[model samples]
Target: MPKEKRPRIKNEDQYEALRDQGYSKEKSARIANTPDQVASKKGGKAPAYEEWTVKELYEKAREIGLSGISKLRKKELIERLRNH
Candidate 1:
């Protein structure tokens, strides 16, 4: 018989490994399929959250789908983003 084939999943090896390590299917797929493998990589050139302006933080929170952030103070926004 021909060798079994996976259905062309991007980063299939990583996905399988994540599954072996007990990640949920959806979470595994998201991490594996992220174009740059950001889950396993870190410390890019972006400034720390504390250095960002309140407006910038709010926008980032909005982009990340964080709720109750519209009226949050800068420190609160930072904490919320970190907690999420």
Candidate 2:
């Protein structure tokens, strides 16, 4: 029998699942290392980004301190928000 190697991440299963879902390594590690109780309760209360107007998205980007949003179209803004 071979010994199983443990990862440094707090939740190996969650990390692997996130990776499989296409999340970046940094994002996966951050989410997996978060406490289960806190992570489960974490989520946005806002509506879907697609429903938001370009102006609304721009304001949100500004609020979040994102740069180079002044010239972004609605879809680009939405993509930026989701990736950010």
Candidate 3:
């Protein structure tokens, strides 16, 4: 038989582990494909999403390239940011 083809996963072990932990395939793949340097880096000093104004939240969503966010309210923006 021909060799089985597999996706180009940067971290196959991490992908398998994430899949076993019930993470969605896309989510698992995205996380597993992240570069080691980026993965180990810490987040910025931004405050909690809850404390951000609606405009700030909208701007943040745009900054992160999140789609369909113009219609989302403050609470929805918070949820989207947290889940993102």
Candidate 4:
């Protein structure tokens, strides 16, 4: 049997729309109608530490003074940001 293809989400508006509808990032990406959409929702190759609005993550990163924050993945960024 052929594998089923997953849809991708493109653009911030679409991503926001899914999010607004109460879809988590992972779920939204899975159901995105296109590959581009999924990529866009993932925040691209660039790290999206800045995209986070959580006060703890932001404040933690600020406290640590970690440079090149954009390169860190979500988990690493969260940890370092939180520890800092």
| Candidate number with greatest TM-score | 3
Q: What is candidate 2's local distance difference test score? A: 0.85
TM-score of 4: 0.26
lDDT of 1 by residue, 1-84 (tens): 995664455898999998899876766877788888565687789899999999999999999888888889999999988766
Q: Per-residue lDDT tens digits of candidate 2, residues 1-84?
A: 874564479888999999899997877888899997887885779889988888888999999878998888899889888787
Please name the candidate that would achieve the greatest lDDT relative to the true structure: 3
Clash list (residue pairs), candidate 3:
none
lDDT of 4 by residue, 60-83 (tens): 576756677766666777767534
**Model 4: CA > 4 A from native:** 1-9, 33-84
> Which lDDT value does model 4 have at 42?
42
Q: Please identify model 2 stretches exceeding 4 Å from their true place.
A: 1-34
Candidate 1: worst-modelled 10 consecutive residues by lDDT: 3-12
TM-score of 3: 0.60
Candidate 2 residue-wise lDDT at 7:
48
Which lDDT tens digits does candidate 3 get at residues 11-35? 8899999989988677888999999
The TM-score-based order of candidates, best leading, equals: 3, 2, 1, 4
Segments of candidate 3 deviating more than 4 angstroms: 1-8, 17-27, 33-44
lDDT of 1: 0.83
In order, candidate lDDTs are: 0.83, 0.85, 0.86, 0.62
TM-score (all chains, Cα) for each model: 0.53, 0.55, 0.60, 0.26
